[model samples]
Target: MSKKFVLIYGDAFVDYIAEDQSNSRFTKFLGGATVNVAAGVARLGAASSFITVTGENETSEFVRNELAEEGVDLSFSQIVPEKEVSGVYVHLLENNERHFERYVDVTPDIQVDFSAIKNEIIHETSVFHFCSGTLFHPIALGTTRKIVENMKKSNVLISFDANIRPLRWSSEESCRETISSFFNMVDILKLTEEELFFLTETTSIEDGIKSMQQYNIEALLITIGAEGTYAVLHGEVVHVPVEKVIPVDTTGAGDAFVAGILSKIYLEGHPSTKEDWIRYIAFSNRLGGICATKPGALSAMPRLKDLQ
Candidate 1:
């Protein structure tokens, strides 16, 4: 049997991507990286599942329906009618990293009964994917920690995206401190080269990989944008080059990579060993490269057939 790939996302939304033009068109897709990963996995015809909490409003309902459409297992997601959905403000630039501002007014505390999360998500999860953006919020921070502690017993392969943001954290030092601490707990750490630099204040990719290896992490995926990707596993480094495509918008490229990597691992790696993980990183990088060539993150996500 293949190990299940379970992902957790902070459910919120926005027409985040605006631009510096009068005739700018804003395309609204699922905003959160975790949520985008879920959709990306589903697009590849894999069993991608997500756990999240949303407010009891139209926004929450829309997100639920989107998850359903993607066929992601939503057994762990919550709809707290007391809160409002999270949101983002994206400033789009033609070929630059999209700028962002987030909103979480009425953000409420969330608690998921471990019994329920395990029964529904853990027993079946081969790998657990986590995000850093959601941790910036105090309301959901402790809840995140509890989920991590509760889920450890299952021996699921842990993957954390140190998706760091200076604007969101209390201070640069504080964010880096928390991120470094958390990455130690997870098995595989995925993030862009920029994130690694920000979190560790290190400039070299080799040094960054070495830094993460201290955590006893099995693998590290460093997304290098249009230049492609690099990975280090069990002290051996491998590189996957990207295929250049005229990019419309690189918004979901990284999320697509996460999906592709997890899907390949879940499908090809029944045993889910350290060895299998090394191979998964290579294939995952290819998936990300494929995403960069296309437009929207969800739409840009490649099918399994594309890999062949």
Candidate 2:
């Protein structure tokens, strides 16, 4: 069966990339974890859809148009009040690393109504992508739960990224609670080395993976930056080496890695062996490595041709 990749319930951001110390020029790009992953999946020749909220302003219009051009569905995405702007963040680039200073408070103001496409699209998905940051917003949190419940009933494969932004949550304990609660519901999880230690409250990566074994997760992908990626598959762990690259910006590399894994699974089917898992991680690492070479997240994402 042909499968669809759907990214559910996340925010959209208009990122302003600063030119230099002169602060004379800036470029805007479509961003957000879900948006980056959605675009990455589509560029890899998969059927991708983004289920999120946006206002009817020019920035939102740019977002809608760009995703549509990339072949991501916006049918289920809702429009909020015109006065309410979509989230905006300033991307500060220094020494090939990126930092963000957000301007908007992403609260309950732009929560999506999943009911809009629940009956029509939820069951048709093969992979449902989730991010933990959405849980910080009251209404989006509830909406995320509703979507997950439906996905459970439909037996859709759920992939989650903690994507933890500490500033967004009320407290570290609360963040852990919200993220930990969804562990059992997800089929695949992607986490950075720091997030692994933070969420599991374990000092080492091995213990962190062991801590999540009680959950129903089938696979866990841990990205250790320059050290490459590790995947826990069928009780065995496999490490894949990353391609060396001179990075221009490393903003959404992890999100692109998530997209590569999902894209490979959608095309090749779920892996049954450690070797299969290794192959998938290698492809994912390549996509991520390529994304880092470019400046913006969404724009920097690789296409199928680029991967070739």
Candidate 3:
């Protein structure tokens, strides 16, 4: 049988990353967490389908064209004339870390309609991935919940990445509450060390994971840059380390990691044993590390050739 595609749903943003620590010069690239993942999966030779809303303008055309160039299928996406694609300015800090400085969203209210998503797409999807980017809007939140509910009824593996952006949400409490609402419905959950503390309201990693025990999440992966990833599988915690790399840009590293995990699950099937989970997490860590060594988000994503 032919392998099923990894279905991703979220916004597509034009990232304006600063050229250096001075934060003066900027370069634009096609980005957003879900956009990076969709392209990353396809770069790894896995089938990927993206679901998002674009516009009829030049920027929207660029987003669609770039995604198509990266081998991402846009068959499930929509094009609305009034919808202006969002843009975010990223500032590089010490250690090549990225800080989201400002977000320019002309049409935050526009979102994908869940009811319009065909049932056959859901049936053919081996893995469905989403993030907290669109959850700040009520309409998008409701649509995400509806989509998750439908995916739950199917055999598709559900993946959620709490790609938290404080600038996008009205308040921290609202962001935490909105993201936590989908924890129980997701099969795999990915978070950064900071996002863990923000969501669980805890200072330590152990405390954060302890607080999240109430949710029915199957696998919880907390990515710590350079060191590695901490994965909670079946009730046991395992630390999966990665080879060190001198990172040039950390933007979209987490998205690359999520794409790696979801692609493996889609192409190879879900990891059944504890050992299986560790191997998958380790592979994802390598992908994230490789992405950081480069510059742009989607451009930095490792293709099959990069892995060799």
Candidate 4:
């Protein structure tokens, strides 16, 4: 049987989240968009495999341990003694919204090499998921492209999330251009309202979809927070709503959402019809909604037991 795991690639981050606007008191947690998704999928009772590089220091050890405890497979991950994991300081607003204050990285050049991944892993991967977090680094970018091309040849489903971090890119144009270049290659693309506007330079969702129609992407999902998701699947547009929830912290909600969708795809096969797509989107929205009701990113991700 195929491994049926969601293969994820990206950087691992140590998130220092502030308790309040003061930004004085902070708590550390295992983070990064891909980390959250990998853990979240595993929590939902699906197989998840992570591809990342970490250092030999205490912080890196903590990240590795946390991911292993979360049931994520790290057999393919690498350890670089000189690589210091990146850190992001997130500040909480009065409304409990999270804001990325700053980022710290000592060795951004260290990244996973495409040659390190075994052929068997690629053959077994049911879906390959990635984001834009590490694309700014040339080495990482090249590796990502190589891996994506290989996965495509193996007929694996490719999922791309435009998890845009403005601070990581040199400029808005560079970010937009770099991310847009991968549109035609992805099987599924997820973006936020702000990200859609930024990439397409359009004010409305309709126009944004119109602008992206040229890519002929299989599926495009626009997350609209509580309002739910706006999806464009095979030239068809649909609105999927979600249950309302008072958010305590919106951190990791998008990751949870993507996890839900990926886990569902891994457990059940990919959606083949409009109704099928809607069901998957609705399930994902519920996960996102539930995640927003709690604190922290990876900590807030819903588990299969939580749903039961």
Candidate 5:
């Protein structure tokens, strides 16, 4: 069975983000890039789903409900019993300088059966995706590798977002090795300026694109917020300038952009040309701008109507 559309294959967990306003603390809402991107795809009115190991706790249950509400089909998640639901602990962000207190490690023992989810979703999808963050973990990484290989057998276009969480890969050497392995595997690669800097080991965007081209990647998106974004495909580079907006909470902006790109390509039936890719980047940037103007990651992720 060929996949219907996009299938996000890893890291569906809670992100307990805290923001301190003056002296008061508040939760920003639960988030994770993979889930956010999956929800964003659904918001784009596309056939997209998520596959990850979820805990059978209240938090996991809540996360499942939240994802369902966001329109992400949850049939692909593997529920792990007797394990604590995972969450990211935080301190406060003063002008985006997020000072961390502690990172709560509630991650369950990842024992997912890759063939099960792949048999159901990836086998029928046009694109299969996962971020680099979770691939750093042993069990999830190993299982995801198997799934990616299986997805390849079905001719699924593998998309990878090297959403490098600073805390996850602290060392530059570790960052280079892990991220490159991820790029080497995926057909499509998308990363922000910060992510490209780390993965390519180049402060220059040109150098970054040059490095990625060596991986035989079909497409590479270099997202530069506010200023706009650029994409490289088939040895040509195209840039899309962003539409300006005052943001309320810029949480899921990047994922929103990714959804926008994928929506244009997979759903709208656009060709993967240099011009088309640039147009998709602009379309995605518009989606990201809209998401930032809203409050939460899920809440801000706009639907197809919002795009118009």
Candidate 6:
């Protein structure tokens, strides 16, 4: 049977992207890390399913239409009451990186229950992608934890991304504690160098690797912006350099990278050796590099043909 890629994004935010922080004009995109991953996977000709909750508002309609057009399965998505609205995030692009300010006060109303879809969808899932953004919302955290625990019992490979947005959490200490607990369930872990420090409380990559051994993780990917990425598998780490691109907007680049790696591994099965991981990382780097050359997250995500 072909592996099905399932992405859970409880916190689906409408992104208002701006080139200059002071600009009054903003370009909107269906944002959220997991959403980008789902779209990118579909673009790569993979069966990608997205799980999210939104209302009947304009933001929700836009997101729904966009995902449908991308060929992403939204069978697990929920449409809440009209008064409830999706979260909104405003991003400012500078120095090939992104700065975010979010309006998620209304997200509590956009509730989700993973148990509702457990038997119908998640049971048949192969790769379950989980990002830490959902943890920021108390209403979503309970269901998120339940899904992770269930995924563990079902023997599904859990792919995790620490797309940490500290400002959204109650406190940095709380964020660290909660995110650390999640590491125990992760099989394939991906995070930026800074996020690695936050979760592991270590100053260097070597120390971070040592701390990660306590978890169920089989492989770890540490992305160092601009410098490249470090892929660790079976106790060995290999550095993969990124291809250069004149970035127009770096939004969704990391999410695109995750999708690229997932597409390769899902199609061929998980990497067995360091060389295999290196090759996957190189391919992912190219996808991310290409994403940087465009604008918006999903809009920037490259198709398989684009990479070829």
Using lDDT, give the best candidate's number: 4
Ordering by lDDT: 4, 3, 2, 6, 5, 1
Mind giving the per-residue lDDT tens digits that candidate 2 earns over 75-137?
A: 777777553434545555456666565556544555787667557576568788889866887
Worst 10 residues of 2 by lDDT: 82-91
Give the TM-scores of the predictions, in the order they appear.
0.87, 0.92, 0.98, 0.98, 0.91, 0.93
Candidate 6 lDDT: 0.79
lDDT by residue (13-128, candidate 1, tens digit) is 54445544332555666667788877777777778778777767777787778778878888767666766666665665646456665544455455333334556566778777
Q: Write the per-residue lDDT of candidate 5 for residues 115-173, one digit (tens) a residue.
A: 56636565567677788767656776788788878777776778888877767656768
Q: Compared with the true structure, what per-residue lDDT tens digits does model 4 show for residues 1-308?
A: 66658999999999998876788999999999999999999999899999999999999999999999999999999998989999999999888878888999999888997888788888889899999999988999999999999888888899999999999899999999999989989999999999999999999999999999999778899999989999999989999999999999999999999999999999998899989989999999999999999999999999987787
The whole-model C-alpha lDDT of candidate 3 against the native structure comes to 0.92
In the range 1-308, model 3's lDDT, one tens digit per residue, is 34469999999999999999999999999999999999999988899999999999999999999999999999999888999999999999987899999999999888998778887887888899999998999999998999999889875789999999999999988998889989989999999999999999999999999998898889999999998999988778899999999999999899989989988887778899998899889889999999999998888998878888
Q: lDDT of each prediction vs. the true structure?
A: 0.69, 0.80, 0.92, 0.93, 0.73, 0.79
> Where is model 2 more than 4 Å wrong at Cα?
1-7, 20-25, 83-85, 90-95
Give the per-residue lDDT digits (tens) of candidate 6, residues 1-308: 44566554556667777756564567878878888999998898888888887778776787889989999889878777553544555566456467776665554645686656657465667678878887876767787888888888877788888888877788889898888888778788898999988888899999988887777677788988677898777667778999777888788999999998888877877778777888888988888889989978888999978966
Clash tally, candidates in order: 3, 0, 0, 0, 4, 0
Residue pair clashes in candidate 4: none
Q: Which pairs clash (backbone N, Cα, C closer than 3 Å) in model 1?
A: 16-90, 18-90, 18-92
Stretches of candidate 3 off by over 4 Å are: 1-3
Query: C-alpha displacement of 92 in model 1, angstroms?
Result: 1.8
The TM-score obtained by model 5 is 0.91
| TM-score preference between candidates 1 and 2, better one | 2
Model 5: residues with Cα > 4 Å off, grouped in runs: 19-24, 90-102, 118-120
